[model samples]
Target chain A: MPKVLMKGNEAIGEAAIRAGCLNYFAYPITPQSEVAEYLVRRMPEVGGVFLQGESEVAVGYMLFGAAGAGARVFTTSSSPGISLMSEAISYIAGAQCPAVFVNIVRGGPGLGGILPSQGDYFQATKGIGHGDCRMLVMAPASVQEAVEMVMKAFPLAEKYRNPVMVLGDGLIGQMMEPVEFPDHLKSEPTNKDAWSTNGMDHRNSKKRNIVKSLFLDPALLNDNNLQLKAKYDQMRSDEVMFEAYNTDSEYKGLVVSFGTMSRVCRTAIDLMKADGIEIAMIRPKTLFPFPEKAVADASKKPTCTHIISVEMNMGQMVEDVDLSVKGHLPVSWYGKCGGEIPTPEEIIDVVKSRIA
Target chain B: MQSEVMFAGFGGQGILVMGKILAHAAMEEKYEVAWVPSYGPEMRGGTAYCTVVIADHPIGSPIIKNPKHLVAMNGPSLEKFAPTVKKGGVIFINRSLISFGANRDDVDELAVKIMEIAKDLGSVKAANIVALSAFVARSGIVSMEALKHCIKEEFSNKPKLIPLNMEAVVAGEKAGKK
Candidate 1:
């Protein structure tokens, strides 16, 4: 694998092409429009289908249409645009369709600022649409990770017969970094023959495959919910990932963060390490599964004195961190709303002041 | 272990191109690098800033609030970023666009007329590339050979424009020599 300098948005598009995603449908939005633009030019050259729908609403439906037919389908959008696609997202999850959605997050309550923000932590993890369905949400911190996650998302979505959401903010979407594309990926194309709505023929005449979430029977819905829960449980056991640094020192405190915030925390750690005020971070890569056990163990350790959750929003992911640590250690929150990314020095100041 | 620098200025000032040159040089030195720009609506006729990180070790954070080095292309950028430069850090300013020099005594300042130098060389469009050349020469931030290699690589895809940009680089370096 050879590393190439690529922007986060362009990396997502390139990785999807290399990952064998032949179908992509999206509408242009801020901080994420590059992903669509890159695909529009590259998709055709790779024998892939790229369509710009009438709007995000229509694009989500197109994703559903293609994904229901078992094609590797995806779409990219930001905060407000993601809001429009939420309804269709629910439908895709309900039908157990394998679709990959990328959210290059921007700040917002409604049509908010275009700066990077992580305020959608809850909207991404807590089942945005409705019903008893969930998405496998992966948070990428860098352009390289963003590319790799986009590639892995297709198979993960198919393995569970669910939607995989690659959630990032404007920073990750806009930044450029060097990344290596794998030469050989374990080929796992969509099971078109077994599940897709392509056609029915002499292959199997006993029964037809209809993909939908609608269940008329109440008992059947209950069973479906249980099965989904089981899938989620397995994900909890298998998919949690985090990076910890300088935790073994005479660390007085811990900084719990994710996505871009984690990178800031790492910088703060580098600055504060010399002062003997050691700080460590637990960055949750998968927000849906929430890396509970890893966080719980870190927070419960006797050497770890206190825990603080830092983010770009006003305490969305902090709540999840709070839930994980619980009463084992005192959990605090710090952040800047409306896409203000806190600096390392500011974060270190807050940690030093709070923990001491 | 890692160093991050942000260069910010208005569009057409060559802020992004400067950052790209530094990134290219860093990669040539066998170091980790990333160049991220403010694009789309924020890029058209608006202020543009880019974060460029170069490190012997893997860079953990790409965003730099208090950059180790600051290169300001205009007055607003200097006013906005003067206080954020790390203590004892160096700041290079384009005196042609910015009237006020670095007032703080904590950091070293080099105020050069980058646009004037580019215009004197018959191309005002090369102002940003000139500023980059100045930074490499005066600040010695990246080596001259490294900057030249980066310039060669950047224009490799667009071979026709190679001569003009390379000329801009030499003009910038010559202006910063004093």
Candidate 2:
């Protein structure tokens, strides 16, 4: 297949469609509005449903309702918008509904700024909402990876019957890159009839599956939480994905980053390597299922003395890096927030300061 | 090999489109490319800029600190980005708007009267195309033929502007050759 030049947001929208997701509900937000804009014309052309809800809050429930009804549905939003949807996301996760949410993250403590940021790292991988629920989060670094991750998201959501989040920063959302949507990644969604409220007649059974997060009995609620925990454990063992750059060789320090920030680290690693300062990188492709072992192993390298987390925000992912290193190595952080991206030279300086 | 180019000008000057076209042309030529725009409130009337990175291998960072080339369409853009161009790199300045030029002695500088050339071609808005043509012609980062094809495709919806854009490209190319 020939590659086509596409923006990351539009590529994700197209990838969702190719992945056989026919329903999309979203509210317009900068750095990610392009996804809704692209899908508006595209969904109808494919005999799908596209809707711009009254607000991000409304769209979250709409996606929940759609996904609960056994339709492959998705939505895209930025930081503040994602915050609005966290309630619904929690509901969907608790109910064990399959949905895909793409958070083209921007700087935010609260409406911080609409630039590339990883500030949502803790929110995404740790607590998106008030629950014991965990989401399958995939962080893609490039437009092509964004496309692949979106395509993979649908099946992954259905596989675990859990909501999957494709997390990227504004750079990945806005930048244009060459991409080819591989045919192999396109697949029919798995059967949701057993658990979905697809109408009694659609399932050819009189029994109706009720989708709700409310468990009145304490025992039943505890059982549900235990089951969710088991599923999460299964995911941790099965779905941890990451990319290693120059990890095969011995290094003085290890850099951990994801999404667009990882690309900056790659350039820094290259520059430092040229200057005879060896550094390796581990870019976690999946933010949740956090690639803990991969990071731990890399940090355990005999020559590796420091683990640095480079992000677009102040020290979010560094906590995870700290956990992965487990005090065997010191974890440091370098970041620029409120829409400022750290330059490769700046990152190199940080690495040097830490390891020196 | 990689070539990183930064295009900067006033918001309405089509600086982003120039970067987009170059990025599209590079993609057409089977190169890995990334185009990142400086997007925000400043984009309303403030100086706008975008970076286009074209590489034989995958691009590491889309946010380039020191670009290999620069297309500065106005005085502020030139004043701001000229020094950031790497040594031995090129700076293509739109002399029609800027009185000052790049002070760098190490890098090659081409100051083309792009707006004046586009005005002669009867389309002032085509000035970006003019500057883009000169940059491509001088740097050879992308073939002129590929750029022409990209321009046609980009303006395919507004077919009426195609001829004027092509004329602007030719005029700029001639100016660049001189």
Top model by lDDT, which number?
2
lDDT of each residue in A237-343, candidate 2, tens digit only: 99999999999777999999999999989988998989988999999999999999999999889999999999888888898889888898889898998889999
Provide the interface RMSD of candidate 1 in angstroms, 1 decimal place: 1.9
Docking class of 1: medium
DockQ top scorer? 2
- TM-score of chain B, candidates 1 onward in order: 0.90, 0.97
Q: Any residue pairs clashing in model 2, and if so which?
A: none
What are the per-residue Cα lDDT tens digits for candidate 2 across B7-68?
Answer: 99998999889999999999999999999988875737888999999999988988898999
Worst 10 residues of 2 chain A by lDDT: A182-191
Writing each residue's lDDT as its tens digit, candidate 1 over A1-356 gives 66777788999998888888878888898888898889999999978889888998998899888887767888889988888999998887777778899999999889888889998888999957888778899998888889889998988988887889999999898887778886534444535555567667523434477887888899988887887889888888888777777767767788888888888888789889977778878888999889887788777667777899999999888788888887878898999977678888889889999888
Worst 10 residues of 1 chain A by lDDT: A183-192
Question: What is the total number of backbone clashes in candidate 1?
Answer: 0
Residue A319, model 2: Cα distance from true site in angstroms: 1.5
